[model samples]
Target chain A: MRNRLKELRAERGWSQQDLAERLEVSRQSVNAIETGKYDPSLPLAFRIAEVFAMRIEEIFLKG
Target chain B: MAAYNLAFRRYIRRFVPLTIAYGASVALATAVIPDGAPASPGIIAIAVLPGLAVVGWLWAMARLLVELDDEYLRMLEVRKFLVATGTTLALTSIWGILELFTPAMPKLPVFFVFPLWCLGLAVGAVFNRLRFGAARCA
Candidate 1:
């Protein structure tokens, strides 16, 4: 999966740690997701969507 | 998170004491039971202590898996265990076959399986580092 996590986080001026804190995950997890090394689970994708106030599809795209 | 930290701390607490117990039990068993000593009840009890300590270690690991909240970290841990299991099984199978065929091969002790599994955990950690760019979950 491809995600706009980095771009969205950048637009909101949120560091990876900030987003990780908000998501209750490690900063490494956020970095992994951003770099496409790991794909978030459905629940985590929803949580990420909720954090960004966007739908899951908007944040994550099919690769 | 506090939960992950708490789980990790609990794992450490259990692991340390279990390790000490394992060592002490092994030393005591070695000293008390001389080579080729017949298995009495007392000797059997002493011999079982180290195995029990290894069980405690397994229990501690299972508890950590259950208590860990971070899904990704939990997944990584599960993967490590899977890798360790596979490695241990494969090596044991190969060694067993070699021992069967080669008369010069030394008989592999069953107790060494636990240590081999532990080594496999280290191998798994290296695998995680190569695949996920982190050796330790924390």
Candidate 2:
């Protein structure tokens, strides 16, 4: 999976840790998602989308 | 959700050290042979009890992680489970091969098997953590 998490987080002036805190995940998990090393499950993808107030498609794309 | 995660982390910090201590004691007993030769009757129970306790603690820890409102916990757990299962199967096969080649080899007791199981588990956990980048497996 690919995501614009880093860009979105940066636009909001949020560090990876800050995004992780908001998403209720570890900073490492956030990093993994941002770097495309790991893909979040559907519920977690929804949580991430919820945090950014965007549709999941906007944040993540099939890869 | 964040606070709940922090709370669970706190609980784990409190539990892990004691669990490791008990585990280490069991491992140490398995590593050393009784000075005069024969394995003692209590050795198997010694290994099995502490090993079972560690497994129980891990199950509880996984439950606590699940309660903390992160679905990724389940993914991390499933990954860890797969790794451990694969490794256990591999090691058991190797042990069986070794037994076939050396039929007179001293039988490993249940106690020795417990620590060996833990060692395999730890190796599997490390593999999962490295591959998945999550400490939850540990």
Candidate 3:
């Protein structure tokens, strides 16, 4: 799975740590998702979507 | 300004005292057992205490997996255990075969296996940090 997390986070003018703080996760988690090293679970995907004020499909795509 | 994780904090609080107790139990057992009367029930009770603590540690780890709430942290933990498990099993198999073939090799005590697994956890921590940039596993 690939995600637009970095782009979305960049758009918000927030660092990975800032996004992690908003999602209540470690900065490494955000970084992993951004770098395509890890995929988020459904609950976490939903949380990420909610954080960015976008739908999950808009943020993540199957690759 | 991300604060320290509260769950990890609580885990440390719970583990430290248990770890201390485990050390104390082993110390007392070692102090008492070298006198050629190591088979008595009192010595046995003291020695058994640390194993019980080991079991508790296993239980605590499982509980941590359930209660951590952070998905990425959970994934990191699961990956670590997988790495540890594979490493330990490989080591044990190799050592067992080596011991069978070599007369110079001393037999390891069965009780040492848990501590060996813990060492695997340490190795896994290193793997996690190197591969995923977690910095620390424990």
Against the true structure, what is each candidate's TM-score? 0.96, 0.70, 0.90
What TM-score is obtained by chain A of candidate 3?
0.97
Candidate 2 residue-wise lDDT, B67-96, digit = tens:
655555555655665666677667777777
Candidate 1 off by > 4 Å: none
Candidate 3 accuracy as lDDT = 0.83
What C-alpha lDDT does candidate 1 achieve relative to the native structure? 0.89
- Candidate 3's C-alpha runs over 4 A off are B1-4, B35-38
Listed in order, the DockQ scores are: 0.63, 0.38, 0.61
Chain B TM-score (each prediction, in order): 0.95, 0.57, 0.87
Taken over the whole model, the C-alpha lDDT of each candidate is 0.89, 0.71, 0.83
Screening candidate 2 with a backbone cut-off below 3 angstroms (N, C-alpha, C), the clashing residue pairs are none
Model 1: per-residue lDDT, tens digit, A1-63?
A: 899999999999999999999998877788889999899889999999999999999999988
Q: Which of the two candidates, 2 or 3, achieves a greater DockQ against the reference? A: 3
Question: Higher-DockQ candidate among 1 and 2?
Answer: 1
Q: TM-score of model 1's chain A, to 2 decimals?
A: 0.98
lDDT of 2 by residue, A1-63 (tens): 888999999999999889988887877678878888788888888999999999999999877
